[model samples]
Target: MGSLVVFFQLAGAVALLLFGLSLVRDGMTEAFGVRLKMALGLGTRTGPRAFLSGLLATLGLQSSTATALMTASFVERDLIRGRMAQIALLGANVGTALTAWFVSAGIEAIAPVLLFSGYVLGRRKGPVWLGTGRALIGVGLMLISLALLGHATEPLRNAPEIAAFLPMLDAAWPVALLFAAAIAALCSSSLAAVLLILSLPLPPGLTVVLVLGANLGGAVSPVLATSGLGVAARRVALGNLLIRGLGCLAALPVAGLAGAALTGLALPGAGLAVEAHLAFNIALTLLIWPFTGPIARLLTRLLPDEEREQEHGPRWLDDAVLKSPLLALTGASREVLAIGDAVERMLGQTRHAFDSNDPSPLAEVLALEDRVDRRQQQVKTYLSRLGRDASEEENRRAITILDYVINLEHIGDIIDKGLAPEVRKKIGLGLRFSAEGYQELDAMFLMTQENLRMAQTVFMTRDRDMARRLMELKVDIRNMERQSAQRHLIRLRDGQPESRETSSLHLDILRDLKRINAHIASVAHPILDEEGLLIESRLRMG
Candidate 1:
């Protein structure tokens, strides 16, 4: 009965620790404000920039995997080069270890004060203040949970059944290493194993080895995350694994000497263990940082070749990165841009197919639609996985991106199911647009393409001015569509193919073209309406 009670208590401790850390992770990201996005956007241009970007992103989100995944998306989108991704991967290792340091230092000690002040501020009903207050409340909860975990472990300190296991650590270090690895893999968190090891008064050598193994085992999460992702994404996951694995391999033989020195020179209260972990990560990063070029070459040789020339190109989302919702959302935006480009091409083909009566162009349009569908589904799945791993701020942004991408996919469907059908009907009827009507249709088609491009640009840059321009073009499209539909109706009444196929084809084509603009406008609205400026414009327009 005592053993069972102890088991429950230990389990509760773990649960509390995870919950507390999760809350703090989310709160910190929210507190960092929005500059993080711009930092991410600008940071991945080169190797060192990507390295700093990964560090900043992980620091903000409190998760290294998220930063790594975000960097992977840059590669997937061709925003950053693959070699830069290798550098970023190395940085994420240091970032994750930094998080463990924060955790071990008991940042939760100030939770109560933060909680009270946060609740007081939360009642004020201001956006920025409320967000800050909520973050404080999260910090408080995190502290309370950490306290709960510490109390839960108190029982194990005196339990005789577990006491027998205490002296078992005096044996070979590999036993402790295996135990740490298994614990970390099962928990799916390096912090979990770190805390467990920290709670025990194990020998210095065994403690260092266990922490090393814990770090290596934690890479399993990233490895598993890239299961169905593209080459760049897979490489990101593989890179994380290699860094951890090689770091351990390099440290394994020499870890004893370092651990002995550190233990012998220690100050007090298990502080040496934390210092040892920190020193290990820092030394390993320095060792690997300069050699990232060689590591990239080695990984390239070890892993199979990337299919860079694959049709529809690389998607930005990688399964390994879904844990960081902010990073994943960033990737989804890039993916949406790619899909938008493909849509513009399909629309161009549809326009030409209408005039040429060439099934070849129509077939090409269909192929583009199919490719967009695949990319859309890939992003959706990635977001769903990301939602599972994200903090609340990340979750909110992810939801927005997921909604936007799904909406964009519908635009692709409109071309496939709606516009394509109209073109085929016109061909079958053997009826053609009158000269003036053809010219008007051509103008509208050109405007639609421009609007699509503007929307993609606005999404990429989050430029309110570009979004405003897209809105203006949408209004122009509405007027042009109205005029074209009226002219097509006149042609029908004048006995110029009063046939069902001809009438339906002409009117439907105009409606689908206008609807496409509406979808683009929707995509642009999120960026523009982020501040009150776009809303003021809309009200004035109304």
Candidate 2:
């Protein structure tokens, strides 16, 4: 019974720490998502800046894995160079270590203070305050968990069972290391693993091994997540993994010496585990920072880019499943989802081309447009076969899927024929919008992208509230377009040469983006109508 109590208490403490970490990450994202994204996008111009950006982003997000995956996504978009991404992840590793060090500063008494302040701030309005408040609350919970962790483990120091097990565990350092690595991988957080190790009463040598294990395990999640992304993204993630894996291999042989050195420092409240984690990462970064180029090149050679699949009909519309309406519908849904993804890529390529004023990025848009057309057509046909004998609910779902894919097709056309041509014209003519006008257009582009993402979610879950939110965003996009046009006219009247030269282009881009968003927003229409929240006509009854 006592052993079970201890286990539960340990699990609870670990759970609270993980929860706090999650809240901090989510809060930071909610508060500073756009700015952070902008900073990351703009900050990777050089190796040093890229490292700093990665470090700062991880510090803000409290998860190296988040920073790594974000970097991977950027690589996919060709936003950040592959070498720079690897360097940035180097900083992210150190940032995670630094976070562990900060959390281990033994400030458990301030938990109440942080909790109170967080509550007060969270009660106030706005995303900034709410996010910051939630983050503070998360921090408080983390500190309290630390105290709880300490109290729970106090008995472990003298437990006869642990006393019997410690020597054997210590003797089998390789097993201990793997054990810690597995824990970190499963939890998907090295910081959590290190903290867990911190609470244990263990030999310094074994402690160092476990910390090394955690670091090694920390780099695995990103690699696994990004395995299917792209050659560039895989390189970034795999590079980080290689760095950590090699560092662990090199450190394992010297764990005892390193642990003894740390022990001799006798630093107050400096848990050997976290301190080792911090030092190990710092050392690894310093050692591997200069080798990022070589490692990136190596990863590229090993993981050559796979050939893009030419349109071979629908990848997800399995004909074998057509006998079962439900199964067929599910397959069709997946196929439409693929079309949505392709449409998203088209919009992204358009934005990239527009931003850089380079027609090269527009090259991919045409190919993606063709893919979207082929897949969407196949999906429509696939679903048409199902609804003939389908039940009412199944038929409704089929219609919903059909509606979404049609909208997606329309969006693809707007991007390919409308937005892509507009962007090319801007690039070909070398016309530049006024600063205010450009910002307006760029904001619209980002808004449309976010709406497409939300639309995908709405299509999948059919959640009425989210569907309503998606419906409401149409008003916001319309206002944004109107206000941008008004601003452009104001600039024109003010005699801004840039505005005069780009007026037609600016307005065309805005109009196309607005049209695209309208189609994307249609994903929510069926969900809202089903919930009786959608009216047929916008005209007020006279």
Candidate 3:
């Protein structure tokens, strides 16, 4: 009964630690997600900057896994080079180690103060304050959990079963390493696993091996999390895993010497596990940072890109369904949805290219635009046959589907012809938007993508409330576009160098994005018209 109680206490403390980590991650994301993304997108111009970006991002997010995943997504979008991404992960590893060191630095005495301050700040209204407060609360809980962890493991210091097991684990370092790796993988956090190791009374060599195992498992979590992503993304994660695995293997035989060295120089109140974790990462970064390019090349050879199916033809349209107008309309609607998906992909790729100043992603936009053109033609031909000998409602539905698909095709064309070229010109000409101008355009790009998604939902469900919301968003988009243009003019008048350099390009892109949003918002029109919720015009009568 006593053993079970102790086990639950340890489990509960670990759970709280994980919860605290989550709160910190969520709070930071809510508060600074966009700016962080922008910073990451812009900060990878050089290897050192990329490394620092990853380090800082991991420090804020409190999870190297999150940092890795974000970096992988950027790679997929061609935002960051593969070599730079590897270096970034190296820095992220160091960041996580630094976090462990800080948490175990005997700071639990102020947990209550932190908790009180966090509660007060969390009660405020704005997202920034709330998120920062929640993060503070998480820090407090993490410190408290560390204190609890120490108390929970006190009984284990003298437990006969643990005494018997420690020798067996120490004797087989490989098994000990795997055991720690499993715990880290289960918790999905090396920081948590290393902290748990700190609480245990074990030989220095054994503890070092356990900490190494946690690092190995930490790298694996990102690879596993990104398994379903694109080949480029998988390569980034896999490359990070390989680096850590190699580091672990190289350090395993020397664990005892390293652990003893760390023990001798340990800071007052700092645990050996924390010291070892930090030292190992620092050593690994120094040793492997210069080899990132070769490692990235090796990864590409190992994980060659696979050819994906082209999205050109209509897969859902069928002649057998043409006999039933309702079934035909359903098939047409589904096909149009596919077109919408294609348009969304094009828009996303273009936006990514614009932000990253990389043209590699634009290749997909061109391919998708061609597919969109072909598929829309196919859809139009298929729907035209259904229009003959159809009821009024069926005819109306067919027209709606046709109109939506046409709008989607137009979006695809604008992305391929207008936005793609404009982004290419910006990249090719080495043009830069002022910070304010960049933020303005980026926000609209995000809003346009969001509106496209909402339009898709409105198309499928025809929900009245959603239709109303879409119409309102149309007004919001117009106002935003006007405001951004006004801001651009103000910047121009101020003679901002970046704004002046990209003046015409900036205004042209803004116009195109607004046009795209207008097309997307048109999906809500038929729904609103049917419900009498749409006004015919904004004209004033005398």
lDDT of each: 0.69, 0.86, 0.89
**Could you give candidate 1's per-residue lDDT for residues 222-264 as a string of tens digits?**
6677667667677777877787778887887766687788877
Note the clash tally of each candidate. Answer: 2, 0, 0
**lDDT by residue (tens digit), candidate 2, 1-542:** 99899999999999999999999998887677655665666678688899899889989999999999988987786667788898888889888988888888999889999999989989997667888899999999999989989989998999999999989989988898899989999999999999999999999999999999998888889989997788888888888889898999999999999999988876556789978988898888889988888888888899887787776677777778777889898888888888888898898889889888889989999999888887887888788777467789998888889888889989999999999999999999999888778777877887677678778888888888667767767887899999999988988889999999998998899999999989988888777777788787999999
Residue pairs whose backbone atoms clash in candidate 1: 225-320, 322-386
**Best by the TM-score measure:** 2
Candidate 1 accuracy as TM-score: 0.59
Each prediction's TM-score versus the true structure: 0.59, 0.81, 0.80
Q: In candidate 1, how many clashes are counted? A: 2
Lowest summed lDDT across 10 adjacent residues in model 3 is found at 33-42
lDDT of 3 by residue, 289-358 (tens): 8899899999999998888775546888999989799989898899899889888888888888887788
In angstroms, give how far residue 139 of model 1 lies from its true place: 3.4
**lDDT head-to-head 1 vs 3, winner:** 3
